[model samples]
Target: MRTGPRAAAVVCGAVALTASLVAGGAGTARAASCNVTTGPYQRQVEQFLGRPVDGRQSAADCEAIKGFQAKHGITPTAGYAGPLTWQTMSVMLAQRAAGTTPNKDGKCPTTVGRIACVDLTRQLSWVQDGATLAYGPVPVRTGKAGTETRTGHRQIYYRSIDHWSTIYDVAMPYAQFFDGGIAFHSVDKSMWNPPGSGGCVNMRPADAKAYWNLLRKGDDVYVYGRKPGT
Candidate 1:
C-alpha cells in the first residue's frame, strides 16, 4: 500500500518539530528532527560577535555559540541558538559597551573523552564530550544539606526511562541511576535550591532529556562541590 505524503507535527511542550513534506513520495519527504534554532539565526548571532554573518549556522557557528554560552555561564550548553544564548550575547554586548567585565562558567574537572559534570556550588551541570561540549551548565537542584548529593566518582549502573520514586512517590523520568537509588532525573524547580532532592540530582525536563541522550550506562558520573544557598 502506498501512503500519500502527510504533514507530520509533533510537539513536546514548547519544543516543536515539524517534518518537511517534499513533492515526492516517502522517499523525498524528510523525517522531522527537534531543532528549534537554525542557520540564519545563528548567522545573526555571529554578527554580534564581530564575525561575518553568512546567513548560515556552520560548525564554527555552533562552536562559537558553545564558547559564548560557556563564557556567560549558560546552562545545558546546547549548541542551539535559543533565547537564552541570544540573551547572554545581548547582555555581554551591553556590558562591553559599559566597559564592565563579563562573567563565565566557574570550573570543572579537565578530563578526556566524555564526562558529565555536576557542580554543587554553582547549582549547575554540563556534559563535555572530549574537548567538544555536548550539553549543559544548566541549573540543577540536588540533595539538601543533610542529604547532599554524594560527592565522588561513580558510574551509571542502570537507566529507567519512566522511573517512579517509591519512597518519594514522585515521577522520575529519564532516570540514570549511578549511585544506589540516586540518579539524574527531571524535577520541579520550585521545590529546589533550599530544599531539593532527597539524594538525587534534580534536572530540568529539557536538561534531563539532553543528559539522557549524552550519557550511557557505565558512563562516568562525577558529582562534586556544593550548592551555596539553601
Candidate 2:
C-alpha cells in the first residue's frame, strides 16, 4: 500500500503480534476467503495503489502484485490467484486483519535466522521462515517528537532486570538493545497503545513473558521505520 504516516505507525504495532505466524509457515495453507474477495487483501492493494481495484485490472495492480510476489519468492506471473500469489495475498490480508502491517522498506535484515522486523507503520512485527510472513501487533512507545526512536537496523544486545517504571510489573527482564534504552519489556496492562510511553515499545505482560521465554540474550530484533514488505 501507499503507506501514509498513520498507516506506517499502525503497521509497526501489528507486526509485533503477528511476527510469529509469519515465521511459523502458516501462510502456506489454503487462501482465506478474505484474500480473494474485496476484503483485507483488496484493502491493502487499494492502499498500496492509492486507489481501488475495480473489475478491470490496472497495470499498477499487476506491477504491485508482481513486486509483492517477487519479494516473497512467488514467481511473478500474470494471474493473481496462483499458489504463490494467493499465499502472498493471504499473508497480507491476515496481517492487516490481525492488526499487522506491511513493510515497504527493505532495511530490516532478512539474513538473521529467527530475526524479526517490526514495522512501526503497520504496528506489526514479523518473523520469517522461508517465504512465510508471520506477524503480530506489539505495543511500543516511540521516542517523543524530538527524540523519536532511531529507525533502521538494530539488534537485541542485552537483557536487563532493570526497566522503566512504565513496565516494572512485566515480571521478566527487559530485552535490552543496541538502540538506546528502548527495550522490549512487558508493559503495564493499562498502557498498551501508541504514544503511551516515553518512546519505549510495550507488550502485554503475558506476551512479554512469552517472548522473554522464546528469545535468548542476543537474538536479532530489527526495528523498521516503515513496515517490511512481504
Candidate 3:
C-alpha cells in the first residue's frame, strides 16, 4: 500500500498480485476462481462506509488503506470513512477494478489476495469465490456507544502469534487507515463474543484461530455499523 495522500482525489492503481509462500507454511493452491458480484455483505460494507456497493473494495485494496494509516501514525481503529480514509479507499477500488495490483510498497508481501466483502453492520464475515458467498457470524467487540466503530474499507497489514493472552495466539490486523490505533484480533475465551473490548474486534478462541489461519499479512478487512443497506 502507498503511504501519504495523493494531491488529487483520483483512485490508485490496479490490483496487482504475486505468488509467494508464507514464512511458516505453504498456503492452499488457488482454485478455479470467478468474478465476485455484489452480495449482502458487500452492500453492508459500502453502506457502513457511506458508499455504494458496486463490487469495489478488494483485499489488496483494503490492505493499502491500512498501510497508509500505519505509516501516518494513525490509530488502527478499524473504521475509516472520512476524507482521508475515502481518499485511499477510492484509489484502491479503482486499482482493483482495473485488475492490476500496483506495487507501491515493494517490500510489502503480495501473496494474499483481496477480500470480496465484509459486513460489519451484521457482525458477519464472508469469503467470496466468484458468485458464491461462504460466510459465518464472527463475534466482535466494537467501540463503545460514544466510540462507535468507524465505517469504511480497510485491510490487514499485520499479524502476531502467541500474543500476551494465554488463550489466543493469533491476531488479525484491522487498523483504521487514518483514525486511531484500534484493531481487530483473536482474544482469550474470557473476552470473546462480548462487546467489552477497548475498541477492537474480538472473536472467540476457535473462530479467531480459524480466521488467523486463513489471513495473511496483507488482507483486506472492512468494518461498519448496523445501518440500512449495511
State each model's CA lDDT, in order.
0.57, 0.46, 0.37
Which consecutive 10 residues in model 2 have the weakest lDDT in total?
29-38
Cα TM-score of candidate 3: 0.38
Q: For each candidate, what TM-score against the reference?
A: 0.52, 0.45, 0.38
Off by over 4 Å in 1: 1-107, 191-193
Shift of residue 89 alpha carbon in model 2, Å: 23
User: Is candidate 1 or 2 superior in lDDT?
Assistant: 1
lDDT of 1 at 169: 40
Candidate 3 residue-wise lDDT, 1-230, digit = tens: 22332210011110000001121111121111222333324444455445545546555334433444433332332233234444334433433442322222222222435442333443444443333333333434344344355666666554444432222323232221222334444443322122233445555557566666665655665554442221
- Model 3 C-alpha lDDT versus the unseen true structure: 0.37
In candidate 2, residue 11 scores what lDDT? Answer: 31
Q: Using lDDT as the measure, what is the rank order of every candidate, best first?
A: 1, 2, 3
Point to the candidate with the largest lDDT: 1
In model 2, which runs have C-alpha deviations exceeding 4 angstroms?
Answer: 1-95, 98-107, 129-139, 161-173, 190-194, 226-230
- Writing each residue's lDDT as its tens digit, candidate 1 over 1-230 gives 21111100001110110011111222221222223456335765878766668766666666666665444444444456766566545433443442211113324444646778776655667786655567755667677656578888787887777765433344567878777656787754421223345567777788899899889988887777765433
**Model 1: worst 10 consecutive residues (lDDT sum):** 8-17
